[model samples]
Target: MEAFERARLNAYFARLAAQFTTPERPAAFLITHLLPERPAFVRAVATQTDLRAVLPKPKSIHAAARREVERVTQCDPLSRDLFENDETALDYIEARAADTPLVLLDVGGYFAPVLDALCDRFSGRILGVVEDTENGHKRYADCDKLPCPVVSVARSPLKDPEDFLVGQSVVFSTEALMRGRGDIMHGRPALVIGFGKLGSSIARLLHAKGVQVTVHDIDPVRRTQALAQGFTVARDREAALTGAGLVLCATGAVSLRGDDFPHLRNGAYIATVTSSEDELDLGGLPDVYTRTPDGDHVTRYQTTGHYFYLLNGGNAVNFLHGASVGPFIYLVQAEILAGVRMLARGDLGSGMHDVGADDRAFIAATWLNYFNR
Candidate 1:
C-alpha cells in the first residue's frame, strides 16, 4: 500500500465509477470471494447503484473481516448470509429477482446455479454478470445459453500484472515454507501442472529461481506454448509426477485424483493454485493424515511406503499461505468493478465476452502512470 499504489487504485476506481450514468440505478447481487479490498469495492458499487445482497464465498472470510465489511457497507446483518450452500444462495437470488431487474457480479462461478434458475424464473431481467475468475469463465463457457450477457475480466490481457503477482506470491510463500523446514528449492526438480496464465508465470518464476521446472497440460496448445517458452513439457501426468520434488497444480480443472497417488515420489510436496478442492485428490489420502500446528499449513499422509505433503489442505496454497496475493489483487478487483459498470450499461450480448480493450487500456495506463510518477 504505497502512496503511489493507493493513488493509482483510486484512479482505477474512479474510472470504473464513471461508467454508470443512468438515472435509474439497477439493483445488483454480488457473489465474490471476500478479499481485503472487498469492502471498498462494495462501497464503490453502492455509490453507483443499489447493492441488493452480497454472498461471500463460504469459509473465505473470518469473523473480524466480516465485521469490517458490515461496518463499511451498512448492509443488513441477516442479509450477509454466507449463502452457506449453493441451494440456499440460488433461492436467495431467485427471491430477490422477484422485486427488480437484478445485476449479478460474481467472483468465480459461484452463482452458476442461480443464473440457470433465473433463466426460467426472471429471464431477461438480469442486467448482466461480471465474472472475475478463469474457473468462472470456464463454467460460463459450458452453458448452452445464458439469461444475460457475461463480461469476463479473468481473461483480459490487462490481468498480466495481477497474474505475475500471483505467481510471485505463490513461489515466495512456497520457498519460505520449504526454507522453514530446512529444505531449499534450488536444484530441485519441480512439476507445474497447467500452463495457463498463472501456471505459466509460476513455471517461469521457478525456472528463473534455478529450480528445474517441467510443465504438464492436457491442452495441446498450452503444452506447445510451454515448450515454446523453453520449459520441459511432460508427455503425460505420470511423466510429470515421477521423481519430482515439488508438484504444483495450476490447471483450473481437476487434474489429479486418488488414483494418481502411486505416481508421486516419496516425500514429495504437493500444492494447488486452483481455488477449488477438486484439483487435487485430497480424498485419496489416508484418513489418518497428521496435521501439525506449524504455520506451513501442511497435512502429512503416510501410505504403504511413501509419504506425501499436501499444502493448505489441497487448497490454493498461494492465497492461504502467501497472504492472499497481497495488494496486487486490487488490479483484478478494479477490472471487476469496471466489468460491473459495463454490464450495467447492457450493451454486451447473451454469451461470454472479454472485457473491452478500451477498458483494459484505461486500467493499464492508469497503473503505468502511477508507477512512473
Candidate 2:
C-alpha cells in the first residue's frame, strides 16, 4: 500500500530512515515502470510518506535516463578530453572511409552528430556510401532518404561497401564508458559471461594490460577476432571459464531466470554488459556474491551483497545504462589509426598488436591538449 512498505522487502535496507532507498523500492518501481508504463510503486510510496512529493513523473524517469546519458557523455573527463573535437578520431575514420565496400551498423541509442562527425571527417575520401540499421536509420533519415552524413548512417549495408556501412555503436559505447570511468575493471568470473562484442572489447583491453582473458562465443569470426587480438578465445563455454580472473558478459542473447555461472575460481570478478530484464540462470553459482546496476537487479558474488555489482542480473552494462557510442568510436578510431600509422612507417615489428596502450594514451592526451585549446 505504501511505497516505503515495498522497501521493507529488502534486508539490505533494514536500517533505512525512509526505506525508499532499498532495492525493493527500486525493484518495485522498475516493475511498475515497465509493461504497464505507470509508476505504481512511486505513487504507493508517496501515499505512505513525504517521499511521494519527490517521486519523478513517469516521463521524467525516461527523461532522467536520457539526461544521465548525456551528462555522462559530456562530463566523462577521460573520454571527453580524448574525443572533444578529436582530429585523430576523424582521421582514422577517414582512412576507413576510403576502404569502400564497408558496412556500418549502429544500435542501442546511437546519434547523428557522431555519424556526421565521422562522415564530415572522412569527406571526399568517404565513398558516397553509408548505411544505418535498427534505431540508427529510423531516427536519422531525411526526406530524400539520405542521412546528413554528419547526422546519420540511415540504412542497412547494400551489396557494395561503397554504398553502405553498417555502424556498430553499442560495442563502441561500452568500451568508451569503461575507458572513461577507469582503465581497470574488477569483478568475479561467473559474474562475467557471454563473449559478445562488448565482452571481446573488454577482454582485449585487459589482455593488452597483460591480464589473461578467456572468452566464449558461438561465432567463429568472433573467436578468430579474439584470437587475432591476442586473447584466449574458447569455442566451448566450459573451457572458456577456466582461469577466468575476471569475466564480463557482452552477449545480448537473453536466457531464462537463474544463475548460469560456469564453475568460478576464487575471487574471480564478473560483470555483464547485457540486458537486465531477461534473467540468466544464476541460481546454481556460488552464493558468495550478487550485484546489479543501481542495486535494482542483483547477481550474488563477493563478500557483501551490499557491495552491489553493476554488470550482472538481466540488465546489460553497455546498452541500458552508462557509456556513449560517440566516444567509443572516437577512441577506437584513435587506436586503429595509430596502429595503421605505425605500420605505414615500418615502425612496428612482426606480430605487432593492433594498438598499444602508450599510443592510446598519447591519443588521449593529444585530444586533451586540443580540448584545452
The lDDT for every candidate, in the order shown, is 0.71, 0.35
Give the clash total for candidate 1.
Answer: 0
In candidate 2, position 185 carries an lDDT of: 40
Candidate 2: segments with Cα more than 4 A from true spot: 1-196, 255-259, 282-299, 302-314, 318-321, 327-373
lDDT of 2 by residue, 1-373 (tens): 2454334322111222132122111110001111111222223332222220121212113544334333322211112222235475465444433433222222322223344455455453221222222222333443233333211222211111211111123333433444454534444233234444335546645544455566666678777876787666665655555455455655544432333343445434345543333225555434545443333233335543223223434344433342233222323323322322332233332221334456556655553443233
Q: TM-score per candidate, in order?
A: 0.87, 0.36
Q: Name the weakest run of 10 consecutive residues (lDDT summed) in model 1.
A: 75-84
Q: Give residue 32's error in model 1 in angstroms.
A: 3.0
